[model samples]
Target: MIKIADITNIEERKAIENIIRNYREDSGTVISLLQDIQGHYNYLPAYILQLLSRELKIPLSKIYSVATFYAQFSFNEKGKHIITVCDGTACHVKGGPLLYDYLINQLGIHGGETTPDKIFSIEIVRCLGCCAISPVMIVDDELYGNLNMQKISKILSKIRKEEMIQEGSK
Candidate 1:
């Protein structure tokens, strides 16, 4: 039997083991277990999912079926930083689509596409629940509301510069 360490790093393997330990008694918690895994890894890695399938005695087909049913779950790897642009009705009225277009042009990436350097990812969501803060851009956990293209440019530029500094130091 292939061990989890054969597919993932020691830290990742440990995380998977811990997650399994939490759900081992209840086989019905597959969704919860997968959700926890996604939280740690950002996206659902194929190998990790296969490892999960074997660990839980669940068929790969069934695991994939559940994973496919949820749009929030992703199989592709995500960038270190996530940039979400809201395009809901309120945000749209406030130029959400225009902002999204600007970002797509500036970053050379659209929804679901990460930058080549894996520094940033751009995503479009229907709503962000803050109508007053319409036309919002979220970078990781920080939110910037009522954003103009200029503000967006500055924000991204600052992040890029910071990343460059860190890379140089490394």
Candidate 2:
């Protein structure tokens, strides 16, 4: 719920502004701008996207395509915790599907869907490059190996507790 103008990171904001200013009429540059925005916000804030469209004179549809086409781009506000399950060839053969189902059912959301309370979003990745930990899942960049449904619940509760503490502090 923060305004992009409220962003305190001057350099990051400048990079986005520069990209838009340099390529106001170029659709190609729109893709790059969206990428940069996503990198800054974890998810592209809707207001910023509108700002870019108006400033760049690009159609909103085009901007949406660029945002949705890339797996990295997320339109919805991402949760404080991002849970990514790896389902590459190695992980798939090693019970990845079950883990995926577990996450979906437990979180009450499908892959790419944020939780109702916005505490977590579950994402499925093709590979995490850790075959040794075939059924590996990452929660906020922290990798967990040899996961089971029980462990997922434990980790989620721990994360929710931590988020609550952080929210209280703010």
Candidate 3:
């Protein structure tokens, strides 16, 4: 286990310390602590998890057992934008796989992976709960349904153009 002193980033150390202090060793608060960590950092970082294991006297395996049980938590760092493709029975019947293939080809990253540039990542989900809008794709919070490759391309292009403009300004 890496010691607290081994963490090089001053801010990260402080954040972990704050988490430990806030949660203490309360057994029931483990999930809450993990949630707090994920909420603050966007994901459970490996170093932070290790520190948590030692301080809480919980085996790393136990911690992982709990974390993996929930889909809400992610171990990998995510991109700025999350693209969710629905592959549920309804969506699948309506060409969801075709949409997914287009996304992997266009974004150059498989589902559950971020693009090399960290601008986009794809997440494949069983359903988004709106069966009426079958074959759905969601970009961040915006929902698009009844999509074809053409519409998907236009949407992706618009987002890329917006990003390029933002990058130029910076």
**Candidate 1: deviation at residue 141, Å?**
2.6
Which model, 2 or 3, shows the larger lDDT? 3
Deviation in Å, model 2, residue 147 alpha carbon? 1.6
Every candidate's lDDT? 0.85, 0.81, 0.87
Q: Give one digit per residue, the lDDT tens place, for model 1 in 1-170.
A: 56676745778778888887887866546688779988998889887788888888889999899999988888887887899888889999888878888899998999989988888888888888887987897999999998999999999899999999999999
Better of 1 and 2 by TM-score: 1
Which portions of model 2 show Cα errors greater than 4 Å? 1-32, 39-41, 56-69
Q: Which stretches of candidate 1 lie above 4 Å from their native place?
A: 25-28, 165-170
Where in model 3 is the C-alpha error above 4 Å?
25-28, 158-170
* Predicted structure 1, TM vs. truth: 0.80
CA shift of 8, model 2, Å: 17
TM-score, cand. 3 = 0.78
* Predicted model with the maximum lDDT: 3
130-156: candidate 2 lDDT, tens digit per residue: 889778999887899888878888998
Scored by Cα lDDT, where does model 2 land?
0.81
